[model samples]
Target: MITKNTNLFVVSNVTNLRSRVNKLYIPKTKSLLPLFEIVSNSIHAIFEKREIEDNYQGKIIIKLIRNGDESTLKELDFIDKYPVKSFEVSDNGIGLNRENFISFQEFDSEKKAKIGGKGIGRLVCLKLFSKMVVESIYTENGKFYSRNFEYKKNIKEGFDKYENPESEKTITGTTVILENFEIEYQKKAPKDLLDIARQIITHFQLYFIEKVIPEIIIRNQNDEEVNLLNLFKSEFESEILDDTFNIGNYEFKVYITKSFNSLSHKILYCAHERTVKDEGLSKYIEDLRYIIKDNDSLLGYHYQVFVLSKLLNEKVNEERTNFHFSDDEEGDSESDDDITLARIRRETLLKVEELLSSFLSKTRKEKVEQYIPIIQSEFPNYASVIEFNRDKVEKIPAGLTPKELDVKLYEIESEWKLEVKIEGIKLLDEKKDITSLEDYKKLYDKFWSEFNEVGKTDLARYVVHRRSVIDMLDKLIKWDSNQRFYNEDIIHSLFFPIKEDKDTVIHEKQNLWLLDERLTFNNLLASDKTFNQIRQLNSNSTDRIDLIIRQEEIFDKATLFSEDKFPNDSFTIVEFKKPYRNDYVLGDPKKDPVRQVRKYINEIIDKEIKSEGRSIEADKTTPFYCYIIADITSTLEYILREEMFTKMPDNIGYFRFYTSDELKYKAYVEVIPFKKVIKNAKERNKVLFDKLNIS
Candidate 1:
């Protein structure tokens, strides 16, 4: 009964299949591509059955069998998780007839064009699993028969056909078994059954909603099955959008659904009633607007929009997984339409981006509108803050709707006020001349504990303020080609203003953190003329070092620095020059910054400027760190090059000096470009900002 003819194309060369399979495209993040292949073939079989019989009960059952303990298994993104060992997908569809069997035996078979078969999906199966076991029953010449075969990467012998003499009629069904997963599939394999099932539902949302729906069931080893269609229907919300897009007589259907119990929002492109390509909607959201916040119902909103069109289908590449819009594939369209595929793809992407951006903007605006009144009602004191900064609030970020701008303005204003109110109070209290570090520590702990809400606001406020400062500094440095020079006094005050009494700095610690985080330690902090009294009684002139900063901890009873390359035990000197200042780059006849700082170093070593009877440690051999920051003029570059000042990574320069004294004093000098410090500090702080969830 099982007869073969010229239509049954047999490959004598197995190496051709190997060569073709190697040229296939595979996605890395999604582990469902292989299963999608098998399932797609099953769907095609179901479609073939529908062609034969009007009322066809098409069922695709997928079983995920595990070798290890199921309880120990978790989600793929979860910390404690492992891949499943095996899987079995069976379908009640039209069996392998002569044409289907011939299609199977040959590579790139064209038998399933009615169901959008690419003829190369089977190769994806081999890529994921070690081998595929196929069993099918078909009627040939009105006689019942079964075909059993194993399709591995490379097989020498072909399938063995068996005749079912007991039954004259064929049982219409096919079963595809995939097991013994190799390392490639096992590495990124989905471990949680439900999570993958949800991904499948999203991936094939348009497929399930098609006219002839196929029931796909995913089950675990325990026989707990999840009917994907039922899950989708029960949690389905109202349709977000349903409309047709027409471009030059080439029309595409754009349908969107918002549903509950879903993890992600996706934009899937389907051609011929099958999902050919997909990407997360959150990706586009992040690329264009703000990220979908991670919350409960507010964040977990699931959406899927399908773009169905023959134009897109024709552009689909050989793999059918991606569109063929490359430059090489252009100028050869035999269709009556003359528009290029790349142009269509570009127009489609732009249109999709614009539509999604509009949708998100409107939706977020509505949410913000609802939330604004509640925030206003709860925080009555916010009005004064909002009123005071009305001008700043009015100037919102571009592209935001009026309502979105209102909500953002409220958040911005409220946070600024709370930060200032809390920080200002703390500064006022600290100015009362606390006698000891112990008292200051107690006050610090009390402030944080008492103003817990403001503490949270301050964390974000610090990042926002630091980011602004950096941007402001950038503008000052690179504002015009004329090389405008900002006032040095203005720059100093922009960072901090020394209390006229020289007690402490008051411009918020974030600016200090920008300079060097060590500058933020409340211990012995003074800026500009605050330290006028601390100047050394040198030979002739008077020029004080910009900053005397170091890390100290009363609790540790020792220096807080670790035993690394250079500890923070020594007194540190930092000098900042205006970006336009060329004086520091002068030669020996002029005032050299190196000698200026060396003078400060010598003064600190010899004079012993006291701090409450405890002087800064300075034996002859005590190490000192000096940092000079300015624009890299020619003389400074020459000095650095001649002094063997090795350039460390990230535009940092280092030079060491050992005065050949009896005690051999040590000095570590670092001269860095002001722009590099500003840029690197801002960039590095971005990680901390993200970690802290700061705006």
Candidate 2:
């Protein structure tokens, strides 16, 4: 009786009117984050049903599969009636009856729902697969009813249809099957199903641990139950949240884990209220999405922080929320409001910083010390350039791309041919005697002794009782010697890169060295080495220049001035210095050797090389001069300002290096510009292009 648009004011069937606008269908994007959110919602759905029914303790089983008979088959394999990729999520919590099932069919654009709001989670199943069949049971009117939704032709005929049968079932739970879906990343040979299983176990480990020991069995292509838990054990323990704090009426749960080598401090778990959506760092990170709120509510904008410390000094504020941590002791008392949320962000960050410091102080520093030998023995070429010291701790600089720097790190460390291997005793039975407390003491003593000798400054005795350390090391040796014996000479190694050439060029700083010591360059040379690895590590005037012999490479500091003559092809000469331990300590040009080398290189190129009638012609010679500092630390910066040179030679090179600890601490390097080296475009560009054409 009513045409398509004739009776638009009908109020009796308003549900269908709203449903038409909401469009209870799936989005056409491939993202595992949404899948994760869906599963998370289902997990809570069961729990919420239990809570509503006053069911205190119940179990929910969730399964993910990639292949099946009625699978969401990829379009390419549709004829075979076989699914190339499929997944299943089944739960045993309170099942959905007629109302819940129909409610699941609703989609909220504004994300306003009493139950997990945005019931579009169901559509996520559809997004990941072609057709999803939800088998659910509901206990209402003193009877249990079973129903499902399958793909069928819609009334329009062009769109897919939703078809299912209603029946009665004795069980009280739900099973969802997604069929005929193509994995955007993998279509034919999809990613291992175990990966999805592992993710389910990992991201929701706490959820399972607090409730049930999830009976997760992953099957290989052969269909045998593969042991997914064993592989997940290492990560599961690390993800467990053992720390708790509070802020702004929200309860914060925190978990922090350091890398086995003790170089990284990561936040494994951080959440607030009953959900991970509203408070701490969300899975979806952006400039605007700062505060995680329940049901997509906005809490704050950009609320994350990190801090470092050398020792424990104060009580961490357990009550503060919505903040981050900073170990800059000088700025602790400063207002947090200066950064973002100001007072709240600052104080919360201070507490987290203090917590981390306390944790670090209590932890033994010897874990990272053992890697030095592995690096030296494994990557002889670049190992000598990097120096890792356990006594030093370098925090990240204030800026962006710290994580991008990590990506560049793996390339360099891998190219450098470094490996991670352990030296000393073997394992016997289920335990390793080499890990005994006594052996730890011995290694500890040996470490500090070397530290004192090389650093020339004995640490405070109270740091670790020397006598106690001797006794511990003695016990360790005796225990491991009597047990499984692994020769100490057989050291383990982990291969890392020195320079990895990728397609994209990252610009950052370079650590230069003019001092008489080798230095690590990862922290400072992300952009510098990236340019070099990409054959772009030169100024505008001389890309063909090679054999960059430095004073530290040839004659030590004392004899550097004696060599006034440099090779004709030595295109660049750069000098640099390691920054002071205390970054705030302004550099003294008189003491810092970088300025001296830069000056010497300039004089040699300007007075000696340029005077010899060297031409920019292909037959003639060219060289440049530059200097690099270990960091932008205050000391090195101070020297740059104090020495104050307006210009430098056209044909010289300069660069700096990073501390070994800082280099290996992260995985990537930042790019730094050599603006000073290419100041004279016309002359320099001519020389560079000429060299390029010659090459």
Candidate 3:
């Protein structure tokens, strides 16, 4: 019978244990966390025993239970082990005494608070397993006692048939049977013995580093036993470097070690001797993206850094999966500076980089050596920037592709330019004090050095652009798979855009320099435009010239066609024919390119040309230079011969001088093949390309 007190209310236990379990978050990948928790409890119990008895040795045995079906065994053709069903962990430590029994019955108990126990490991166990059964024996007041209990979800009191001190027991130990692994979690759990052992080692690696781990053994149904202590010593043990750092008032201890089994360098955050969070070291130090290989032994290794601090222990959530603080520094309050995980990690990585300085320096040097040639041959624009900023280049990660390297070098160059700009401004500042004549001279010289280097980089970029244009022109003139050549408009647009004039297209957008460097300084230029459309010509005829240029003494548009224009002002008419085109009809002004140029020049001389109603200063003595760019086919060669044009000494082109009696002027004409254009352009830019060391 139960008696009711006069109190208005009383503290009550949770009614629905399943709802409590559902509230906890357990990721599928972390299905083994339940097993780790039970093992951690056993380890803590052993620590409790050691405190009482000095000579006592701690030992734990984990038994694996698997499904024994003949059909399932036959179906697994390659697997030697069956799927595990449950696990039974036994520890010869202080069993559940009366005080511990009371603590176990309550939720959120603080009995094991000194050892970092959150009093919810058993709840975590029920998340994966269907039931938990415990049997233990302990001595109280010089007398041996026994306890037995079974925890299941369906039980109203969370446990059934609780027997305390029911009968006498000889020894003291506890065996927890976590039975009936749920199918959802069992599929995610590791099936192999070695894999399971590795998970345990990784989880409790901090304990192993502290030399406080106990003797743990894993046994399968086949009686195969694995001593975890031996596994740690042979495979995971290494020379460890221990150090300490501080973030604000919180102190942190770090343990750095090398492991052959690690695929990449890692940083693990620990709280209460258990790793709660981890991040790849490559996220901070890119050189550690892959394992570090040893030349002498041909073995690859990577670092495993463990960080422990009291603040981390206090901030650890009840699930021990993460901390209460934010992961990013910005997520925390501005008044509290060092409470975020990112802040702690940044400081910790600084120490890690300091400790691995020698290894990192060697690897960085090798990376820079491999990258120098790539910049010289493929990215000449960054050569000077990289040479001056070697320290920034060393900070870049290794194993980058050409495209990635281009982006990194571009970023570095932009930063260097900004620095140079800032320095130049400071040097010319009126408020800056002139300490001495030598100091001022030194500052001025340094500023000019960086400024000149920037200028050289811009020039190199322009040279590279020229090389690309030359290559494109060479490819455009080649025959296609269909045995046909590119049309005239395609080639015409390469030098100057069709239907556009100098007023619409800037000099930088046109490649007129490929034909003649002097053409780039034209006072007026037009492509694919009729005589009537030109502002400098007053002719009403609609004959479209392929390309036309007019040069004057002064480059002012107002004086381009004024009466003050120089007598030496000249006119250039260029015509483009399809590559390898042999369909030329002699004396047909439309078909014959030479006659076409002559007709356009005759109209220009006959017209009353003026700018803003001012008489043009041109006379019959003004020179006319005409060019026809096309391949020297058989039919075109005959046409050139009939025009009295003499072949060039190289036999690649033809040139002639024609005297016009009606106009009283002399005209120079040339028929240049496509090959000669590419060859001459390359010859003109060879010196610059050689200086930049580019192909």
Candidate 4:
């Protein structure tokens, strides 16, 4: 089937130039990357010339071209500057000779591989600029020649080579004019000359640090020029540290400088003497969240950290914008032994901390001192935790709010508790056969100490809760700016939630101790519940009571036995009236709290008491106690007189006993003001509060 003339098919490698350009990732924020690439190339070109001539000095000129209707722009008073349309970068270096021209035509050329060239920076330029034109004059074999070309994205060959007349001029140089800046990229690019200079200096900081940088200048439309070298020297202070470290068989060099003009602490990763990635130092070291002030000079400055490594240079992507390494160790499977960006950052950060130890120590000490009072006064529960974890506490960052500090301390405490628990479990699991007496005693002492610490932590938490409740009560009793007091329902819910009974609300959820500590030891308690809803009372009445308590003998288990077996039952009822309310109508049970309690007592006495399907004790002979909590208004005083109540010596309350033969019951009633209740509670818990240093 094959003959000598049988045509042989040829397969050529096909590449979609447009698709390749589209594959490049250039964020709007990095719109100036294309310009940086051009500058980098110019630097490389200048370096190439230095190899040929020992006394050659490199010079690069960047001229900004702008577009605007001069007449119209003059008429607009708000127009300060015209929009940039293009840029022309001229460099005095090895121009595009025959070998350079061939390299330029080849895609991903390796001609400049020895100098860390990716050979794809030109393509990156096309991502932002629509057109590129190159004009160069160079010498080959001592003969002056000229090469001119125009590059376009839509062209098949990517550019058109133009023939230029041989130049008799002696100066050799290259000029690349990038035209038609894309609107999207133009919006993100820096227009100010100072900003442009700063960007260039930041991108090429490594060369500046090494003192091998050329003289680079940026000129505006009005011929105003800024020398980048001078700008760098004025804005960046002396180098702070120059060090090297190894990461997994790779050596990385870190150069740190104190920058007087930087907005924040920055860490720039460089590859091939060009910055590839930048991150804020605050992301790792919290103390660097803002500009730091030197203690000796009292000048504010931020650090500019530059890191260079051969591994990074070799791992740079084709676009030269980023590297192939993962940012975190956890993202890579071989991170245990292999190098990662995060590991490099960790190593550098350790060095940074070591260099700035004095500053960090002072900052931490001041921050901890500022936080101590907050913990002692409002957050006493964390006092012990912070004391034990002093070293960890000193590492906490500054400028955290009280709430944020509380959350962080809570995390530290939880971690400590977990560690203690684990250690205690391990100790308990060990066998005692091989343990010496002294060792056993030491272990036992340690165990007991930690055990007591756990108890103290629990107690501290409970005491903190109590203090908060007391503080809340103190504020609740005060009048607002409007001269209005909180309603009775608001204060009632603070002591015990409304519309709930013992079956629905747990004992711990109620702050019954605020009223009377003995009330906390109740057999049954209900708040804002209807008589029909109480399980122990056999009544169809829907009258709701503010609060009701039933108590039996302390040793009696009422739930396990019949109610009749515990005849020594006592009942208590509490009613809360609106604070400072003087509207009281006697003889109307609905408006008078005393009559209301009487009505509830009579109804309960008439109803049989039962528990767990067992008939129980009668309540007529039981001793009943009632409390009327309200301010001693004039109308309330008149009502108290009518009820034959005697005022206490303090003149803030009244008490009386009611014995009705017809009702066959004896009851004691007390009318106490809200102020008195708060005062008594505070006095009772003052000693405990003092011990905890809480006010």
Clashing pairs in 1: none
Alpha-carbon TM-score of each model against the true structure: 0.44, 0.36, 0.72, 0.70
Query: Measured by TM-score, how close is model 4 to the native structure?
Result: 0.70
Q: After superposition, how far is residue 589 of candidate 4 from its true place, in Å?
A: 1.5
Tell me the TM-score of model 3.
0.72
Q: How well is each residue in 1-695 modelled by candidate 1, as lDDT tens digits?
A: 13233234333334455555667767656556778778877888888888888766889999886667656533323422446767788888888767787677666676654345767677877776777777777666666566656676654332323332323445677888886776766777778877778667765666766645599999866666789888777554243456565667888777776543345666677777766777665553433223344344364456566777887778776556677554554454444456564444444455555556666565555554554464353333334444454444433444555456547766776676577677758667666667999887876764454355445545655565676677777776654566677765556555555322234444353265655666565344334432445432222324455666544543222444455533334555667667756654434623466766677666556654555555555656465667777677776777667656777676554455645565335677777676777876767798854554332
Give the alpha-carbon lDDT of every model: 0.61, 0.36, 0.79, 0.77
Better of 1 and 2 by TM-score: 1
Model 4 C-alpha lDDT per residue in residues 1-695, reported as the tens digit of each score: 11121122221224555677888888888787778878877888788889899889999999877677645544554432566778899999888776776667666777755455677777788889997888887877776766666776766446555644466867778899888888999877777778788778876777988778999999875667889989888875354577888877888888887765568898888887777778999888887887776667776778888888889888787666677875553343435466777778888888778777787888888989999988888778887787677878877778788889988888888887887888888888987664688877877787667666766776787777777777777777778688888888888888788878777887677777776786677655568878888776767889989998876566344542357654566777888887888888787777887889888888877787676577656465677878888888988888899999999898888999888677666788989888888777778888777878875
Q: How far is candidate 4 from the true structure (C-alpha RMSD, Å)?
A: 8.6
Candidate 2 vs 3: which has more TM-score:
3
- TM-score sort, best first: 3, 4, 1, 2
Give lDDT tens digits, candidate 2, residues 429-453: 2353566888857655554543333
Per-residue alpha-carbon lDDT of candidate 3 for residues 1-695, written as tens digits (9 for 90 to 100): 12121122122346577777778778778788778878887887788788898899999999877777635544544332577788899998888777666667676777755455677887888888988888877777777766777787665557765566434566677888888888998888888877788678867777888888999998776666689888888777756767888877889998887766567799988888877788999988888888776876787778899899999898887767678886564343433454888777877888888888888888889999999888777888887888789878887978899889988988988999999999888767757577999877776887798899999988888898888888888888987788778778988889888888767887777776787777777755568888888776677989889888877664443433346643456788889888888888889878898889888777777777775567764456667878899888888888888988999998899999877576555688989988998887888889988987765
Error of 4 at 277 (Å): 4.3
After the best TM-score superposition of candidate 4, give how far the Cα of residue 261 lies from its true spot, in angstroms.
5.6
Residue pairs with clashing backbones, model 3: none
How far out, in Å, is residue 212 in model 1?
3.4
Whole-structure CA lDDT of model 3: 0.79
Sum up the clashes in candidate 1. Answer: 0
How big is the positional error of residue 610 in model 3, measured in Å on the Cα after superposition? 8.5
